[model samples]
Target: MTHGGGGALYLLLILILVSIPVTLIWLFHGQGNARKRRAIGFSQIAIFAIAIILFFSGVSYLQNIGFVAGFIVLIAMLITPVVFKNRV
Candidate 1:
């Protein structure tokens, strides 16, 4: 089986779209714990990078669906600290 280059582009676009909001929250969460938020954000970015790589290489069974799942997880991760406020 083979995948097309378009798949990688789509995944990268989606990744950017999903990351923008999370980045804004990360930037503007004035009361948030800097160290905690930074760590969480970094880890999620790393996961996203891996997801994109796996999708691009066509070696993982997850395919584009993995990126979708990653986006959902990123959204959830972003929301958690916002809701918790002081604890984050």
Candidate 2:
């Protein structure tokens, strides 16, 4: 049940789809403190970059846990503030 190259493509698409709107909202909506917003943005980008690096660095888990599961967790991290805005 492995998607191989196609799984990577799907993960990239999901990141793009989720990132665009989230970035726009963060950039335009003044959702929180400027520093926190930027922090979250940088963290998301860093996580994504790490995932990419791991995938290309011959990491075996990339084919199994890197794409779908990783991206979903990444997306969740990206939007966690919004999901629990009142608490944060």
Candidate 3:
């Protein structure tokens, strides 16, 4: 892939799309407790930060795609808390 604006956008889109499902699974089905949730959340934030960097670095790096996917997954991760919070 080329390191141009279009490629960067493509990578971003792909990453966000992929992350959604993974986030949902982790949020809903992962084992552990609140601590685990906190850990996962922090880890995901770190991962996302890295991904953003990678996404911008170039268009061909594996992390570009991975990070985008992770971001998508993170949306789900973020939502779960709000969803449950309203109920509880």
Candidate 4:
């Protein structure tokens, strides 16, 4: 819960890691669907914010693991569309 420079940097890294794949998805599949992409992006941002808040708010270890597992599943789902573009 230290609000130091390191904490800010950690958050920035988390934001970047979460945003990169979403940005790629936005650039590719979101070609004509601006509104949809915007909504998806906002939701991702919100999810990341919630995860960080939970992390800093002294959430239990099991809950944190569950959150991370859910995040990984979400990322996998997002990547699936890109990987199998024709099917999606």
lDDT of 1 at 30: 46
TM of each candidate vs. truth = 0.58, 0.60, 0.42, 0.48
Candidate 4, 1-88: lDDT as tens digits: 3345345445455645765676556645565555655655556556655665655556567445545644654565366446544422
Candidate 1 C-alpha error for residue 46, in Å:
0.5
Kindly list the per-residue Cα lDDT of model 2 for residues 1-88, writing each as its tens digit. 3455665677677776777577556644655566666676666667666665665555567644555555765676567657645432
Decreasing TM-score order of the candidates: 2, 1, 4, 3
Instruction: lDDT winner between 1 and 4, please give it.
Output: 1
The CA lDDT at 22 in model 3 is: 56
Q: 1 or 4, which is superior by TM-score?
A: 1
Clashing residue pairs in candidate 1, if any?
Answer: none
Instruction: Assess the local accuracy of residue 46 in candidate 2 as a C-alpha lDDT between 0 and 100.
Output: 73
- Top candidate on TM-score is 2
Q: Positional deviation of 47 in candidate 4, in angstroms?
A: 1.1
**Runs off by more than 4 Å, candidate 3:** 1-34, 61-67, 82-88
Clashes found in each candidate (C-alpha, N, C closer than 3 A): 0, 0, 8, 0
| Per-residue accuracy of model 1 over 7-88 as CA lDDT, tens digit each | 6556557657866576657645646678777777666667767765665565556665665666666666556556656777
Model 4 ranges off by over 4 Å: 1-29, 61-70, 73-88
**Model 1 segments more than 4 A misplaced:** 1-15, 24-29, 60-65, 77-81
